[model samples]
Target: MGRYNFKLPDVGEGSAEAELVGWQVEPGDTIVEDQPVVEVMTDKASVEIPSPAAGTVVSVVGAPGEMLAVGSVVLVLEVDGPGNAGDEAAPSVVQPQPETPPAAEPPAGTERTGAPAGEGNYVFKLPDVGEGSAEAELVGWQVEPGDTIVEDQPVVEVMTDKASVEIPSPATGTVVWVKGAPGEMLAVGSDILILQVAGPGNMTAAPVSSEGPSEAPSPAAVAPARATVVPAETPERRAASPATKPGFATRTPGEKPVASPAVRRRAWEHGVQLQFVPGSGPGGRITQDDLDAYVESGGALGTGAPTGRQPKTGTEDVKVIGLRRTIAKRMQDAKRRIPHFSYVEEVDVTDLEALRVTLNAQYAKDRGKLTLLPFLAKAMVRTLPDYPQINARFHDDDGFVRRYDGVHLGIATQTPTGLVVPVVHHAEALTLWECGAEVARLAAAAREGKASRDELSGSTITITSLGALGGLATTPVINYPEVAIVGVNKMIERPVVRGGQIVVRKIMNLSSSFDHRVVDGWDAAEFVQRIRALLETPATLFVED
Candidate 1:
């Protein structure tokens, strides 16, 4: 046997370094030549580095999220013969270190057999997101049972009330058990997965009778039970109910009540103390029905207390997941964090409309039909030079504001999934036709769920419109981190006095919101007025500054 050092090849045009996104193989894993071994992300694209020779992976260099330069030794492997590493190179003999001790190989028959049932298994619990949420819905799992996982790799994506985040694995091991299905809510501190790690793991429990944890308790033991109400008018009648009476048990005077986190949260919300509630679940555990029965028996009723009402028909519970959940979180964060100040201005676009119609008539075949949005985009690009602060991002946590010289415009588009803001990058460099084309392309890509991650992010400012569905005026929410958002309202022909005479003209309203922490009221108003002036004149939009 011999040792070989594998280096990262140049993945891009003259690229010197790449971010180590993740590893595909760990130590002790066997690989073949030309197999992808590691994934690195460059400025242009994400590339997977392949193994140069078939070997057993001995070790990997650098951790995820760190920069690894090209031509650096990324992996060391053990091969069959005299390898590339010369005799003068490091020895094939193992070196001793104090931090991590080497493990003894298992017996011949038990080489690949996982820790007998539940022994040597680490239960990965759901962690508190610190948003005061007691539970999060399992959106999806990246790995399956029996798949190997590494520390700090994303194993699951969970959606909470505040945001959707990926939960990273805490230990390197093989997945032996997974808890909840997608769309099921899992409580904080509840086991989400069980991993079979080397040596004694973080958890020690009773032996299972089956191959895996199939014989273990159901994951629902940690999930919230569904609430079912039975009609009972009096306390005596409630005590007679089967679910509340049979197998029911209560805690001792000093013993704390046993309940899932979901039930505890419900009790706290209704101002019902668990010390007084009876447990009707297995092993003296309190279920959701127990709480309801307690509340019906004249328990403490706070503002969250349910009022008596007639029973209604069946209702469906739709779990919020995926894109809808993301939109909800971002909208909530924008409203909660930004102190918004809105300014509305009316612009007469009769001249601009006439110019647009003439341009379409003259160049309809050569150029695509131009909409008002492209014109509005051009006008904003022209007007942003005088109001640099409006084209900026506010990093509230970092306590800094980044005002950009380039205009990367976010066009709010409505898709079948949800509302998405597809960006038109470097809008200041594009012509009016080019801006329209780019917006159309991005919107199509976003609606089809085919937009790349780079195409959806990095916007200095945003423009939102509802097209003909737009009302008189709207208070647009500034996209979080961006200082300003421009809202385009419905355009209509109305009778108005023009040059002392009542004349009909095409009019539109520009309703915009600015982050009060970064932009003042006077500057916001002046900014809108400048955009209005450029749009209303229609000629100055083409003039060089």
Candidate 2:
């Protein structure tokens, strides 16, 4: 009999370090070849290292939460037939060595068995998207297996509590396998897709148990035919009633608490400390319900002390993963990369509001309800012919501006999943009624997380509104490649002087943000003035573009 020293292989991101997250097998646990032995988290993604050969686990080198590097022996196994002795293998197990290229293997704790694929397989694990993200819901896949794809092309969209993310391909190859179905949640370092390439590939995927972990990297477990990707508030995050408030769990000003990644994310969002609230789960494990109960009961709320009757429960830790991570990254990028100039124009929409009411009443029977947004969209599209700068896309890396002849306007819609902007292609070609209908359709699709890639992207410009809840005017951020964004503000009635007479008029503000690099202040203001004029003189709405 011989002993084998299984070292940690490269998880693919150039980094040599990974954090030992969990161990699937302990000392003396008999494991099979390719069985997941431990899970490790890298900077880029999380992965589960499988046993290279079937044998009894002699010793687990590192405990959970320990940092391990590539080439370092993570575990030792006594195989029925092997070369090395156990005593000799155990000494060099913890020694660090040069980093190797990461393989496509599952992280320290993940593998493929569910959603069996066709033909050659190359599984790509999901990465640790920083900011404490662990799992994300499978929003959609951009490419199907058997399709040839170039490197860096987007492959899938995953939704997390923080934001929605578009995961790109790691290499240029043919996709041979895909695991999860739509609306399923995958952990940060589990196998997401399999690409068949000419060179090396990840470990082969084998069938796993029907019941295992849905997100966490567990090789023995396989997801069902359709697994539910519950949002943070699903029954999964539930805690004992009236004990703790999940929504109120905040970031305490001390060491991080012992909460799951999901609960940690929830606590971070609410700005409450985990220590302030109590845990209801086993061994001080905090559940989402406990956090919510604490919130309802008014926990410390950043004070580190619950003045309003602190519940004896505990706090949970949820990782900020998936869609939420994507949102945070994109929002940060837009703000940091682009120079924005905000322009606000107050319009006497008294006439425009009247026109809207009349039109809604007229179309109430056949067409759906109409809001000022449709009018605003029509006005922007019509006015774009006069000022083309606002309706454009800029490629910063290429330093080139792409001006589109057609108006593909993006409407930012918020759903329970996250915020998504659905595009209305050729807005200039549509009538106001058509615009309203298209907006409604796109908004519905986005809210349902069913908007196609084309519907979600390719906007020359964007328009945002908070409806009646729009608190005055807002300075909207430019939608990256798009040079400008127009925001619709709340409409309120106040006294105004038109013909030397103080009278009440429906007033609203058009707040616009433009890329100062492309659009000048004079042009920005004039474009908005034109929108205001079109809305005030509703008769101009019939003008052909």
Candidate 3:
């Protein structure tokens, strides 16, 4: 048996390190080639690194939440035959072997070179992915300037208000320049990036330089064509200042906290403001120990019980990234593009609750139990036909509203990552049981981060519910392009005047919002009332038109 040191591969473009999320396999566990071994997260996404060769895990390195650099050993494996570790280890004794004469040089035009022929500067443009949109918002960059990239490697992600997509590189090369920053809009066919390639490229006709090994000049023999001037370090600059040094307890005012990504993540999770926590590392750099000390000192203001009544001046600025950023941008765009008007209405679900309980008690064994959402979904599916204007996508740019006959319900779900709305396609055709099942499936997929693009988008109208944690009321932002969004608040038993005397009744409020441009106030109210009528009467949900 031979030992293999499995290192973390470069999971993200130009990412030097990744946060170790978890290990799928433990020590002594046998794994096959292509089996997922560890899960890590870069700034962009969480990726599961797979084993390149089958082996039994001998040992594992790094804990969850630790930042591991690319190519660093994360696992030691025992495999059949000689492994990579043996080849990499230093030799104890030198063994002499007979040397052979070098091979003859290749003929002209057949000289073997490392780079591809005709390599040159290639300008990659933003492709039109058939979204019919003229421009797309730059979400984030996967590769940075000066980073070497391969063909088909995702360089950037862009959103066209309809969907988000990763733009891959057309040719492999070194990135010389990038077009735009995140949040900026770039037109289709516009240059996205410029790459420096080996051969004659798509742009410019500079002749390729070809010099033989024997003809190559030494560094001292020839003055360089372009000389790179490096700045000289002065004695004071070379010496570490307290501010720039690592092992220090405090930092200068307004200086950002210096900590490793892992330590920063830990601090964020603990809600310990790094600004208030004095670091013990060089240059006032915060470490894991420092974060632990701050938390133990009861100085963490983000979580746990309050330390004191003293004014908490510590504030941490968190740069939103990935899905959170996408959500923020969509929400901001929704509010800005669509004039929203909110409508709140209360519903009596006493009979509905009784029916739900009875159904769950009866069907919980054979069939899956149902939630209030399925019932609400059934109500909306029935009600939308009466007010087609509410179930539509408004192309504000085109000055038109496209209402659909089929209902694609978007169930707004909150996951460990962030908010995502999984669509329940053809909800109008699905039975109550099927609707409940689909919602459950989609919700699970979303929460697990396994939801596909089809499952995540294409909602004619959306229904967002907080379930038990839902408060009394909430004005939900409309899922843009779709004219309306229905927000379900908490369900509670409260005293209400019924008939003559006050009686305890189960009540829930529907806080819904609509695009005022397409849906009139009366129409929105009427549409919600229709749903209320269907839900309040639960029996009507089964009766078809």
Candidate 4:
């Protein structure tokens, strides 16, 4: 059979290499044209690579976890004909090369003299839609290769460093080929689909060079009556136990044992595992507090034991992968690029808490419990008009701050993976109940990894809360590009003098960070104080003109 060499193709965003994460096919395995062959991880995301021609895999060029330069030979396959003997006759593979303009092809159906207009076949490449600078992982495919797709319909969901975006079909036609599978990374300029159009007199023509074997049968041809199907998640068993293996049971003969990664890491770092510790996590997993308690109880990591030996230092290597890496890059950019400052205040929210409790009892079934966030958001929106500077963003290039009239407040949420801030669009116009409902919806979506790019961006300001975790005060970081962020802490009981009588009262802390270049300290403090006043009085929050 003729050997077809599939070289790593250029994905956009200047990516020249990718890590081979997984392989779907092995040597000697039969593969269909356009079927996924491998999965790759790049700085941007994980992606799948599809077969270029129907063939039997002859050789795999690389091992998983190995970094392969783009345009390199990833795999070699024997197609419909005998293999080429000379190296010159075989497809030469190299690492991925920089993006170049693709060669033009003749319009489809033009081979026939009486072909119908608008019936030409075409191949569509995934476009660079946003400020995306690297390859994107193919998280999912709405349609398989060879499946007919309609214009404007979403065909694939690509996960970039920023967010997942759905790629839409470019035109209505029969899908002739697909070049990648779910979880494979595809470069920005890469060809994602090939389409064939039915022409006049019911004529059809091939899109590729005739020297190659005939194209594989389209999905429509083989399954004409089948309905469109959505893909489902594959099931796999995962480890469910927490017992330690034989070799890692103890530290040294004299060292006390600490269970779980969180406790061990902290104890090892702080040299506190020498004392007795208790576990509180799943399956009695040692938690951070256990290590803290041990340290407070006079524990030490043996007198001279050099603090865990610096992890055998050599090359400081790190892989920029997943959500944590994305957050790091964004935060770094924000700090380096934006001018920031801080403002703080404390609010007496006793009245607001009473109102919330009353409302929850009144609309228990219809609206659930009301949170401080919605009320705070409402107060911020109302105060924005009086201290407009706090609601503005500075444009460094133009030397002006653009003040926004509409309020879009981003709520910072913490998830198992990482922290995400999803926005509540047009918060100023929505009622307290509506704001509460929207906040709940967005927060839930962010926790579930279902927040879209739009939901995560375009915020005029942000609100961050540690909820019960935050004690009396905290200084929150501004979500860059947004000029201000409000930090809400837990409400606690403290002694206060009321009419010369000492009494305990519920009080909360309000800390706000702002872009000092845009908003002055005075204005920022005033804005937070206004919110604090509204919360303390409660009636002011529901005031109508």
Mark the regions of model 1 whose C-alpha exceeds 4 Å error after superposition.
Answer: 1-183, 186-312
Model 1, position 379, has a per-residue lDDT of 91
lDDT, residue 447, candidate 1: 66
Clashes of each: 0, 56, 16, 19
What is candidate 3's lDDT per residue for 422-537, written digit by digit as tens? Answer: 89999999988999999999898787655765677799999999989889999999998999999999999999999999999999999999998989999999988988998889
lDDT tens digits, residue span 183-235, model 1: 66888876667667876765544443344434223222212321211123322
Give the per-residue lDDT of model 2 (tens digit) for 1-545. 87788778876535555655567887788888889877665432336677779888777765433456678667777888754664664744432322222665443434544423443335578766433557767655555545788665657655544333445676767765566654567887766765665544555553343664343343223223112322333222222123445554444332223444445445545644455567776445566788788777766232344568766765544444545566778888899888999999898988887878887888867987888888888888789988887899888899998888899999988865357788999998887788889999988777644465567778999999888789887989888989999998899998999899999998999899999989999999889898889999988988664
Name model 2 segments beyond 4 Å from true.
1-319
Q: Rate the local accuracy (lDDT) of all candidates.
A: 0.71, 0.68, 0.70, 0.63
lDDT of 4 by residue, 161-205 (tens): 434445566566766556554456788766566566554212245
Model 2 TM-score (2 dp): 0.49
Q: Which of 2 and 4 is the better model by TM-score? A: 2
TM-scores of all candidate predictions against the true structure:
0.51, 0.49, 0.51, 0.48
Scored by Cα lDDT, where does model 3 land?
Answer: 0.70
* Superposed Cα deviation of residue 246, candidate 1 (Å): 41
